[model samples]
Target: MGARELTIVLLSAPTDCVDDDRTEQSLGLAYIASTLQAHGYSVEVIELTGLRSSELATALHRIPAVDVYGLTCYSTNYHSVRQIVTHLRSHHPGAYLCLGGPHPTALPTATLEDLQIDSVVVGDGELAFLSIVDALKRGRRILGAVGAIAPNDLDDLPFPNRHLVDQKTFTRTLNHCRTLSLISSRGCRHRCLHCNSVVMGGARKRVKFRSTGNIISEIRELKKMGYGALRFSDDNFADNPDLANLLSAIAKEDILYRVFSRLEQLEPATVQRLADSGCKLISVGLESLNPKNLRFLGKAGMLHCLKNLEHTERHGITVRASFMVGLPYDTDASIQHFFEKASRLPFTEYAIYALLPYPGTPLWENPERYGYEIVDADFTHYVQMGVGRQTAFVLKHTDPETGFTFHPADVLRWHCLAHDLFSSKRHMSNSQVG
Candidate 1:
């Protein structure tokens, strides 16, 4: 097949309440585009916010016929993917449609089964995507079954084509001077029953970390570009000892950054090193206080992890603690216990989210066991809006030996309102004290 001019339009599906204001382009797509372009294929990534379903169809109709159409899907935009695929199949029947990212990786069979989608790239799509484009150019049939799926080897993947995304969109969402998203590694070691990473990356867990030299090079490049703050998006940033070494290296470079850490792994010395390394914030997942509830969610260390928040705070690094309200083991008393414990902690900011059982997660596999009913399968509802049966409230018949119940959404709402009221009262009390 001679060099083919392929018009690849990348679209980020919309989220629930979040408007189309800034369509965050997936860094994965940018990597794939860069690889494909290196292999001599024409590609263009466009954020699909302003275009309506029909308007998108009209726009596609006007463009020169595309060889392949690639669409990126997250858990929140699965439905939008279906809609776009359906429309594209009807309007532009000849163009090949491909889906990638967390959603497609998690539900490859479903994506392939859907008549509209031609193929789904499972993991580390750079090589797989290039292969698919090559196959298409050679007039070979592309099948959806997992092909060329490999572990995320950071060294192999090209630096993300940040130039593809609109600079204005990024500036509005991210404080680039103080904030830049950096993916030092890929894949997670811990399998939280409710997390999408477990489903997408698979059970064995293939993790690849960028070499310290490569990471420092990128940091230096970003620093030269005038980015002040760095945010590492690794699922478990502090899991490896080498992470400490990485921090030490960053400190040598005088770079400041923020990272998410599992509470269990954090040690006082490590916390001090993190602080000395110019670490400004540490986000810890203090999902719940109940040991039984924590075990059920596959969290190994409950108490020690929760205690690390204090250590992080004491080290002069702000702790952004996250907690989940509804778990199968939660009751009214447990909810109160969570609040009391959280209020005692020196968290600079707290984010509370109701348990959302995304499909393909262990929780979704046995919703009844978790006391969660399928409120809706639509991916938009998967964000944080839809309600599910509190796992803590209902007893499992099969597991009569053990049972639990909790109303996640209700408790979360109460927490939000309580925080507001408590803050107001605190302010009044301070004024009276003055």
Candidate 2:
């Protein structure tokens, strides 16, 4: 059969959510699907979200039989992907199966063995995946896996195929307007121990940005599609050196958006520019108020967080501050002190998460070097929330100078305490505004 005659399915494993309300599809899988379609190949993008394992087979049964299956895997969804591949192999033995994403990239050989798949693609999968399709079309069987080469120019790639999923039905919202996610960059400049961005971004420790013209063109396309708001999915949207020009371009387009930042980049002028560009919100990772904890995580100090909140407040933009609860040297006393100081901040929303040393991250590879000991290595418990069953695995203090560490129960308690504190604060603030 010609390559165009073969059916290709790019399946995305269900995302982990606090609730089953996710409507947006995986942008990464969409890119691969779009790439395949661009090459005049038949491609179908299937995204599964918030479905239990028992429901997976039923969902798979609904999909038409395809010649190729490519599944996206992450640590949180590893087991689900395994179940999916098992079912696929049993049902369609002749199909070509492949796995890719952060989890598989971290342990490609093990993933291939565990899932019993044909091959795995590590790192950026756009070009590598297209190459795999080309090879298969030439009737070559791939055995183990191939390392993906990062694209030097992100602009050369086609925009994610949003048509594969219902973009208008996406439930993500900002300022009461439906928001769709978009990425203008790849990689990060920071080397936070708890983050795996550097691992997935390959050996490069620097950020790569799409040209301002390319990004604006995509925004215009989204706007024409009736999307009023966008969520910039970059590691740190403000990290782009051409941010000023990009912001100016976005302002001319007259669209609403939100972005994640480290707060250190949010100077008074930058914050004002962001506000002027219709930026309604900024999410900052204010990991901790203690300088020692900040240093441990390789994050900016509390001063940055305070300054970020001050500038955003002045510019009329909301700040959603996220904090980590169970870091090295975090004791009950120190946590309470953080609560006291954080309560006085002007952030509009708060989220408290536990520290998880994900596989392939600096912390997971060398816990002792960072004054912590991994008590649990289960990938299922590597989530961010500290108050739920999906909370991060327990980490113990290994350094004598650290003084205190979070016990498993303490982690939950701290998360609950912070949640309640901030919940009440938000309520009171809303009341005063009303």
Candidate 3:
């Protein structure tokens, strides 16, 4: 029998609480699978987004023969990944298993020591994964390896294989419009404390962009694939010379979309161009209103962000102001100040979040410097919402407060208060629009 038919399974831990919930295919996994396909490997994508735990093990067992199994996960799904990987190791003893993505990339040694995963891909999985597969194909031992970032030539990577997963059943839906996710660039080296970008990208604080032609080509492809809009998943799309060219080209296309970008990059001219280019909304990550916290995140002053928000709003683009709590030295006064500013801002929507120190972030590595102690080292509790096994608990706390005994609970409470105030404002605004 000529060269044995190589088979691989790519799994993404389910994000949905309910089974049958669908979503766009995991871009990272799809991209890796595409690379493998180009190398003559048979691949299938198993997105565990909505499967119930009781059904998961059996379901995975039912898939076709697998010589290699690859899993992509974030911190929130650490336990689920363990469960899945453990099952595979126990049942498919001869198969090679690997893990990639933010969690494994940040803690490659810990990942391999866990004993469930045979190998870990540390950085971008495209090249690293190809290498691992080639090594395995040759029957060479390459365990305990770390994947590194792709070389600077981002343009050389193939576009994500959108066909690997069903587009109609599993796609991003916004107001009855079909949306596809695309990342025109990668690696924002911004020093946002809670960010895990450093581990996934690199420490150079440099960004690389896809060629403008390549970007528009993907957009055109998405359009041809029946996507009415594009959701860019870049951490923050910084303004560059190439962006204007891309936006100008996109203006001729028939699509609407939104993007997350830095406040500093949104100059008057850039905001105007974004609006004119069918940009429906711009998400500004106002991580905190506290000046120290702002500086900590390498963000400009709060006034600078506010001005950008105002400018974007005046240009007829919806401003989605996203805020986070649970930072070092956050006080009741600071949270209240944030609420006042957020309520008064002329924005379309607002969201509040708690800071969960992800594995590779400075915050997680050195919590003592921030004056909070890490009470738990379990990676599964890094989740931000809900109260299930997958939901992360707040395992860090401050020293006893003088009055309120401040802690993560207080941060959550303040976040709730802020959320309620803005939600009411949003409701009233919608009423007025009606």
Candidate 4:
């Protein structure tokens, strides 16, 4: 078959949760789909989140026979992808199966061996995926890892294929406004031990920013599509050196948005400028409150985060503060201190999660050095919430200073408590806003 004559179905596997609101659109697959379509190939993007295995199977049966099936893999969705791959192999035995995304990118050889599938696309998928399609069309035997030649010019890539998804189903609703997600930059500036950014960016750490004009043009395109609000899905918004100019350009466009940034990135002046640019919310990862734990996680100190929270509050922008429980050095007192400090904070929203040592992260590679024992290496249990929230990974050492022995169940115990507190606080915050 010729490249243009081939049909490709790009899909994301089902997540543990059936909750639609919690899931975001798969922009990675959307970008890959767009890249494929631009080269004159027939492409279909499927969102399988919030579906049971049986339901997913039923949905897959509905899709017409295609030449290739590309599945986006992540640690949380590893098993789900396996289910889809199994069904495809049983039904469409002739189809070429491909896996991409973080999980496969991190462990391509394992994903290939464990799943017994055909080919894994590492790093960027656009150019590499095109190469895969072209090679397959030529009847070339492609196996193992398909090397990626990532686009150095972000402007050269096409906008994500948003048309494949239903806007109402895919877009996020924040503070009574419908918001769509977009990325203005690739990679992140920080080197947080648990972060997958560095791993996903390949060995050496780096950050790449799309030109301000390119980003503004995409925003205008989104606005024309009836989206009044947006969510910046960049790993770190403030990491861009031209942030001020970018914010100024977005201000003239008159669009409200939310962004994720390091706590240290927000200053009084930057907060004011963000508010002026119609920023309704700022999401900061205040991973830990304890200085010792902060140092271990390679995060900024608590003082900076607190100051940033105050600045956002002063600017009337809601701040969603996310915290991680069960760090390497965490103790009963330290965990309590985290919640106690969180209760007194000025942020409008709270998100609490257990620390999952995702593959390709420094923490995952050297868990023993950080006082953790990998009791469960199963990718399904690697998820932070829902189905497999409780897993085998546990703390192995007692805090020498506190003489507190950490139990296996303490991680889930602390996470549940923090989650309860977060839920109650969110309810109260919503009640007050209402």
The candidate scoring highest on TM-score is 2
- Which rank order by lDDT, best down to worst? 2, 4, 3, 1
Per-residue lDDT over 1-434 for candidate 4, one digit per residue giving the tens place of the 0 to 100 score: 55457888988887654233234778889889888888888798878776766677678787667889998988877877898898888888888899999888888888899886899988778889889898888877578888767788888889998899776665366556777889988888778888888767755356778999999999999989998688888888977889999989989998888898888889888898899998887878888888777888788565555767887988988887778877766766677777877778888776666677788887778877776666667756665444433333334555655666666588767776766556535621242221
What global local distance difference test value does model 3 have? 0.73
Ranking by TM-score: 2, 4, 3, 1
Candidate 4 has an lDDT of: 0.77
Candidate 4 ranges beyond 4 A from true positions: 2-4, 387-404, 416-424, 427-434
The CA lDDT of each predicted structure is 0.66, 0.79, 0.73, 0.77
**For every model shown, what is its TM-score relative to the native structure?**
0.84, 0.93, 0.91, 0.92
lDDT of 4 at 258: 86
Off by over 4 Å in 3: 15-22, 385-405, 427-434
**Candidate 1: minimum summed lDDT over ten consecutive residues — where?**
425-434
> Which model scores highest in lDDT?
2
Question: Mind giving the per-residue lDDT tens digits that candidate 2 earns over 101-208?
Answer: 889888888787777799999888999998888888888767688888677799999998888876654567777777788999988988887888967886576678
lDDT of each residue in 91-175, candidate 1, tens digit only: 7788888888887777789778864677888766778888888887777858775554563556766676667766455522222
- Which residue runs of candidate 2 sit more than 4 Å off their true CA positions? 1-4, 15-17, 21-23, 301-305, 386-390, 402-405, 427-434
Q: Estimate the Cα RMSD of every predicted model relative to the unseen true structure.
A: 5.2, 2.9, 3.4, 2.8
- Supply candidate 4's per-residue lDDT for 203: 54
Task: Please give the lDDT score at residue 132 for candidate 4.
Answer: 89
What is the Cα-based TM-score of model 4? 0.92
